[model samples]
Target chain A: MPIHEKSLIRPENIIRHESMNLQGVDVSGDWSTFIGSRTITDYNEDMQDEIAALPGGEYIHRCWQCGSCTNTCTVNAIEARFNPRYWIYLIRIGLEEELLRDKDILWQCVSCNKCTYTCPRDVVPEGVMKATAHWLELKGHTPDSPSTIFDREFSNQIFATGKVEEGRVLRRFFASTGQALRQPWLESMVIGLVSRLPVKMLLRLGLSAVLRPKTRKWSKSRAAITDYLQQQGRAERRALHLSAGEGTHV
Target chain B: MTHKEPTGDYNGFGPGWKATGLTPAEARRATDWVEAKIDRRALLVNKDRVEDIRERMWELEKDGEIVVHRIGDQHEPVVARTLYGWEKKIPTNSLWHHKSCGQCGNIPGYPSSILWLMNKFGIRYLDETDQTSCTAWNYHGSGIGNVVSLAAIFLRNFHQAYVSAQAQGLPVGTYYPLVHCGTSFGNYKEMRIYLMHSAELREQVRKILGKLGRLVDGKLLIPEEIVHYSEWLHVMRHRIREHQVVDCGNLRATIHPACHVYKMVPEDVIYDDTVMDGNRVAVSTGLMQTLGAQVIDYSTWYDCCGFGFRHIIGEREFTRSFAIDRKIKVAVDEARSDVMIGHDTGCITTLDKNQWIGRAVDKVYELPVMADCQFAALACGAHPYKLAQLHWHASPFETLLEKLGIDWQQAKAEFESYLKDVADGRFETLYDPKRAITSGPGFVRQQGDQAA
Candidate 1:
């Protein structure tokens, strides 16, 4: 039987003969086309277990390959290569090589939860995507994505002050991510906002930046959260078989 | 039955299979099962298979494992049905406002509009400074924060909401929380399920809550219902419509249902038969319809605003591209939408702020975006600049204001003078400024304060 979905078969895997003859009958070009068979040997047998150890990846075992996640994915709508269903299949089968092929785009999962809403098997594919992205960063298969950097900056502010000042988050994120704060669109957006000259809003933004809005009496909560996250970080590292100090850059 | 000739062509199948000798309506009726198979309503009908966390929460509370914050008569509870036909009590009065950090920081108008609406209805509420963000955006964007931390924050905020009214000589449960962010609403619901299902998570969170003095009766506090402010607007649409001073009948509006609000823990979201045939998640649409606006349907109504948590801050090009191409462009070209209304902070920010960037790529779809509460407030004659704060929005809302017959020039002038007044330390507030600080260092007990 022929491969019905030709897109699944890579171009290099298709072998077509330009000139051939079989038993005095011409069997050339399209007639003699063949699919190249390749064996995958670099399978990490513990890939599924390692992913399931993460918070969002807990339900990866429940996926029944329904493809609803990919079909309803917000990112997959624009970027065809960001397929959650395909990645989930690769992870389940321990096909690490194939999974790494699309590692860079994994962090682009928007967490829209459309897939989780549509999943009949309660797979929560959105969480699996997050876990896989985290796994990639932790295992050093990929660098920390901009998304991860932004998350760290945002989360750190909340953990510290018990509230996030948006201006602080944006400035810290952009600075940490090594991006300029003066993008054309950003400048235009600020100009547009300033054109109206809502002085109270401007003063509020300045005041919040200077005297960052915080949850009052947040010292106890901050201390508790910091301790809890440290404990979780150690546990996650243990699950991934990384050293206690490994993957601490995040 | 009258037989009609087949109009469309079919290939590969035999002529016998090509034509069913049935009318188009009959064919549609015959294949209605296919539509029903994909319908969200039908999918939710199998609710028995999916666990209702509220039942387990009640069980846990009964077993002394947790304390459920009940919505009492003081809250003026109005019961609404969820997607699975489950009952959810939405408190319309004596509410504790859970403000979104993003809204307060970015779109100040979003929460201000909500508060303005509540004030219009003379609803008793507390807009205090005690609550923290749900912190789910960072979790979703970066995956650094775990469920344990999220659950702790969830309980901590609810505990504060539970006890916030005591500063004003009221009992502990006088105020029920009305979450103002879609992200928090969804995250709290998911966290509630996690806390209920896993005793270990509850125990872990309870310890943190105890340390912060946030526990109620030495147990973690959980809200009876994680209610969104839009849900409050939805249930009060009839009464809100009664106060409509501006004619919004001529405006065509499109609602971008926040994914977190509807898609995450979808069973808890409100669905009304009167709104879009109960097909869409019916908060923004319901309010818009009740305000006498033409709620137009667009193709990409189901798409995310492309805030993407991280995408907005890190990879904003993707956010702008998706917001313009998938959402704004379609709404303008297809639906001819005058304004696009959304409920979530991120969605409004993404859709509103990103429109200006489209000019860089020549995709200039200039659709104004604002929250449903902002639109509702506008319909009720709230000042666009003073209350709704439309000037902060990056989108072209001036056209929308003109179309609504609102005088932007006069409003801008009035807002400019108001800003001068603000500069001189004289300003108007929706509620008393002293009520904002319920506890901590800056809090000074009012004359009516009583021990709880």
Candidate 2:
């Protein structure tokens, strides 16, 4: 019997989502802030080499903007505007603002690394896209991205406790991200229930959380970090003063 | 009629958590069953098992017993390493670089730090150029860009690198290789494969090249090799080891190879144990082992860092969900490692940068994430003090430093001293051309843009 097209394809593979929801989070700042800044041309030394060292740096220069990288991308299948070809073009053009404007798109990459996996030239587009996003963050524009909330709260908690206290990290993240707290009584009930779970489950979780390891205090890990930051800060300050761009007191 | 009449009292909905009358034991059993299924599925797809199976197949193929075929309709078997020999024989100089968008924000220091290290090695390189991001992120996430567009950008960059090299008195027809982010390295390799097989693509690229006079003397500008930094670093390992400019002392580290780099090119992976290695690849892991860090084995060492294309974009729940479950959760809850190290930038960002968020959502795991370099730097004593990135982390490296009884300040100073020493030639050069040439395998012939 002739196979039905529907039968030939898995029902689950059907694409049905409206797609907008899958797009990147919207940036809040004016696009103009990034447009004129020399940040686009101001590549960190070895930025090029770093890209070259990436999975497919060799073929990145081979792009002709045919959009196949985007056409074949699974992410674009879910969201139309999130085009990889356009971003590549933007980076190639040194349009720092355009790249930064789409910070959400960069983070939205699921990193299946499929584009690079599928890229004809071995461009490893995902890494390039990722590096661009990193550059944007250094410029101080955090995406209204949920992921950032977790990073910030986690860092803040770790800084305070010298170890990650999950319970504290969760509570702080909820508060910091403007997520409404679970009603006190509701939370209490949940905690009570959790406490009542099998001894093994609770024991495992509790042990893992408490045994959170700490860096040796004598290692002066903290001081080393501060010094590096200070040195980097000073260098950045000097660079800014020399370049005559707006400067911050590092 | 009697049954119907009795049912008249019942609500339309199923049991409202009361009628099933499940005992606590029953409830717990049901929960356990569900959790078991979850664990089972995770195990089956356990990234570790996947790597194991793939590695076994690789060994079989290497022994000429069987040939591995490419996935699905792709007629070609995935190309393993033809470039490794070339990379070993001739070192790369003056390359065109592409960037990764995601890592640009999260781990801002990866590229910068790598570049700084390269310069410290006295490697001649160029960073300035109008190079573009490979745009793989958007393409992978949005599916808007097509192969033709990608090839166009590929051609443009190659054209630029070739011209730059020519101007510098390098051979005019030479292929100036590119270093990349994410899957750019793999994608380029694939693109070359596609071009070799497709007359249409080759012709198209040729026409484009012709317009720009890129076909110097009607020959392709062959790039030397597409090298991943992990492999590049591995190549320099002996030298780095010999220099011994800094001491990392003692620390425990777990290495996470980028899925694109390791899983995609399983055979070519220099440290094949993890990708092809059982729980870990000895070479990559051995680098750390030799550094004197305790390496721990975990169940899900080979799982994707949740940077999978679909997970990162449309199915963030799955993306975030899996990342937490696979890497972050396993590292902290299972492996109990102090610092989770990765090879590539994207993995470093997702696994290293995303660990905190994973913990916040599920209150169990919180492991400090770092790249292999950062972790190695820690070991080499190059990173004397706890890095701010680590200090600001929930499981800061400071605690580890403290445990080691290290003077963070002195370490930091020493690390700085090493950097200066490296810059000032206080450290000896490890690459001896004569020894490398005599060892084995000279550089592979440059494969210019085959299509053009």
How well does candidate 2 reproduce the true complex, by DockQ?
0.01
lDDT per residue for candidate 1 within B317-435, as digits (tens), equals 45666787788988999999999999999999989877764554456777889999999899999999999998888877888999899999999999999999999999998988788
Best by TM-score: 1
Off by over 4 Å in 2: A1-250, B1-97, B167-178, B218-224, B245-249, B271-286, B362-364, B380-395, B400-452
TM-score of chain B of each: 0.89, 0.63
Residue A150 error for model 1, in Å?
57
In Å, residue A66's CA in model 2 sits off its true spot by 50
**iRMSD for every model:** 20.7, 20.1
Cα lDDT of model 2 by residue, A1-250, tens digit:
1112335433333222222221143322211011111223353343343333333343456666777678777788998767888877765655555555567666576677778777776667776665545444444555445555666677644543466777667777788778867978868988989977998988877786767656456246556655775665555434323332432222
lDDT of 1: 0.86
Model 1 per-residue lDDT at B265: 94
Q: What is the TM-score (0 to 1) of candidate 2? A: 0.44
Measured with C-alpha atoms, the lDDT of residue B221 in candidate 2 is 38
